[model samples]
Structures are given as C-alpha cells and as structure tokens.
Target: MDLSGENFRIMILYDFKSNLTVQKSFVRLRTAFEDEAPCKTAICNCFAEYKSGRINLSNEFRDGRPSTAVNIDGVRRMIETDRHVTYHEIQTSLGIGMN
Candidate 1:
C-alpha cells in the first residue's frame, strides 16, 4: 500500500502492539515528528481503526459524491447553445454537485 503517511500509522501500530496507551503514542509521535506529526484526532482515529482490526493504511472510501464528473461534450454543447449560461447553470444541466 501507499506508505506516504503510513510511517506514522506504523509507529502508532507498533506502539499499540507494544502495549502503549493512546496518549503515550500521541506523545511519542509528537516527540518524533513535532509539527509534522498528524493531529491527535488523526492518531486516535488511526489507532481506533487498527484496534478494530483494520491493519492497512490505505485510504478508505468515505460518504460523498465524486468531486468532478464533468462531461466535456455536454458542457461544450451547452456553452455553444448559450454563451451566457453561468457555471451553476452548467452544473445543473450536468447533474453533479455536493447535494
């Protein structure tokens, strides 16, 4: 899996396996990484997941629509048909948004 920030997670996992408390792990990370360390909440969440049997550090899918699904041809046609259309109009026509 991607090891980008997994190093920190591995540190957490190691501390967890070594029977350290969450606060201890958080302190260890802060000592090791200082400002570069993930937030305390991040440490807690990652540690919680690992405790719940999630061992890997890859990204998990969260609840949300994909950020962008624009149809280029559809947008081109809409713009060609009406040059005055606003961005919201195009978004409405394409049916893609946070809602």
Candidate 2:
C-alpha cells in the first residue's frame, strides 16, 4: 500500500497523544503500515524535531536551494540559446531532471 499524506499526520498525532518514544513509535508505525512504513530514521528525526518544537503537524521551510529550472525566464533563456536542443541537452545544461 502506498502511504498517503494523511498517514504522516496520523503518525505525528499518535506520537503526541501517546508520548511514545521514537523507537516505540517506529515499531508502531511499522506494524500499522506494514511494508509501506516510512524509514525508521525519518520517524526518529521527525519525532525529535517535534519534541524540540522545530516542526508542527505541517511541513515547514528550511534552508535549501530554491527551485530554478521551472522559472519562466530560465526556460525561455534556454530555448532562446538553442532552439534545436534536445530534452536531454536542456536537462544537462540546466542541471534539472525531468518529471
């Protein structure tokens, strides 16, 4: 079964309500989701962040490079530079993978 976004919220709620330790939460989630469970490290880190008041039920922005490949100007510039460029060439030049 694929994990739904709501599952994360549920897990976090479970953690909060039960005050389960990270390892216990990990095991609980593993059993709850079976093979579809998220990685143990991710659960541990998320719980740690929650306990530290670093994140809430929702995701928060942190430090990271802003996505640039989808910018209209960037795409326009790439096309203007080489109208004959293949998709592979554009991906290589822009350092962005296609969806």
Candidate 3:
C-alpha cells in the first residue's frame, strides 16, 4: 500500500490516544493482556502480541507501519555521513536552485 501522508496520521492516532505516547500505552496494554486474554483478531493483535510477551507494541507497530520519517532520516544520515552529498544534488534532481 502507498503509506505516505494520510497513513502516517492514521498510524500516529493508532499509536497515541489523548496525550499518552505509544510506548506508555503499550506498557499498559501489556499488563492488561495478562488479565484479559483477549481474542486473536487483527484489531487486538498488537495488544495480543504485548500480552503474549512476543514483542513490544511500538516495535510491532513499527514493523507494520510505513515510516516516511525513517526515509528522510536515512537520507539525512547519509548526507551527514558523506560530505560529498550536497543540496545541489537534490535541487538539480528537482530542477530548482538556491537564490
């Protein structure tokens, strides 16, 4: 699937509620998993995974979710790691130049 913009928001919402971070929510869900023993459906899969002690919720979501931020970070890390890279390289590809 094309997981670009809208999908990103969906992921954020899925990961966070109100003001709680995804990590904190997963920790809470993990504790509940031991008590609730919820169903095997996909909607509850993340909670299940946390319950089963299989994987952290964030990691599960991280694997399932598409990350445009990671893509940008990768490019930035590459540029930082390699001095040869330049804004001109990107600009020329887009047919734009610094003023």
Candidate 4:
C-alpha cells in the first residue's frame, strides 16, 4: 500500500487503542494533518473528530438557538435521542459534545 494508506491504517489502530476523549482525539487529528493546508486540515479534523465519536453531528439544536458559551449540543442530542445509549456510545458517536 502507499504511504498515505499505511498512515491512515496506523492512525485508525492508534485511535481505537487510545480510546481518547473527543478533545484529545481532535487534537491528535489536528496534529496528524498539521502539514496539510489550512482548509484541508480543517476538513480532515472535522471529519476525523466526527468519525472518532468525539463529537456529534446532528440536526437538533439547543433551545432553538446555538449555544455559543459551551458546546454540549452533541451530547444533549445523543442523550435525548437514546437515553439508553451508554457513555461509551456517546464517546464513540460522531459528535464531540459527549463528556
């Protein structure tokens, strides 16, 4: 496989083993793609963060307004959507609001 593919595979394994929190995972993703251009890095980080379950990407908004102070909408949405979902589920979901 090419270097890029090999790197991604390594990242996936590392991500799975680390069991890192959303913020930490996001930081790692940023570091991973730091060499890329700004726009590419931002997109990569956003997608990576989502895939790592460190953040939530849902349609539900908080109180019909975006919370500018703290970002918990992702957790709130996940909890509301399925209260039975475990803490790990929230952690593994594609959103970062989980605690």
Task: State the lDDT of candidate 3 residue by residue for 3-78, as single tens digits.
Answer: 3323333343455434455555545544555334222343345544444555433323444545432246655666
Q: Write the per-residue lDDT of candidate 1 for residues 4-99, one digit (tens) a residue.
A: 576777788898899888899888878877878778888788778778887885445432355666688998999999999888998887885735
Model 1 global lDDT (CA atoms, 0 to 1)? 0.77
Candidate 3: Cα lDDT at 1: 29
Model number with the top lDDT: 1
TM-score to true structure, per model: 0.59, 0.51, 0.21, 0.27
Candidate 1 regions with alpha-carbon error over 4 angstroms: 1-3, 59-92, 95-99
What clash count goes with each model?
Answer: 0, 0, 0, 9
Candidate 2, 14-72: lDDT as tens digits: 78668888778778887888777767777776776667776555445542365554556
Report lDDT (Cα) of residue 12, candidate 2. Answer: 60
TM-score of 3: 0.21
Best by TM-score: 1
lDDT of 2 at 68: 51
Candidate 3 residues lying further than 4 Å off, grouped into runs, are: 1-15, 35-99
Clashing pairs in 3: none
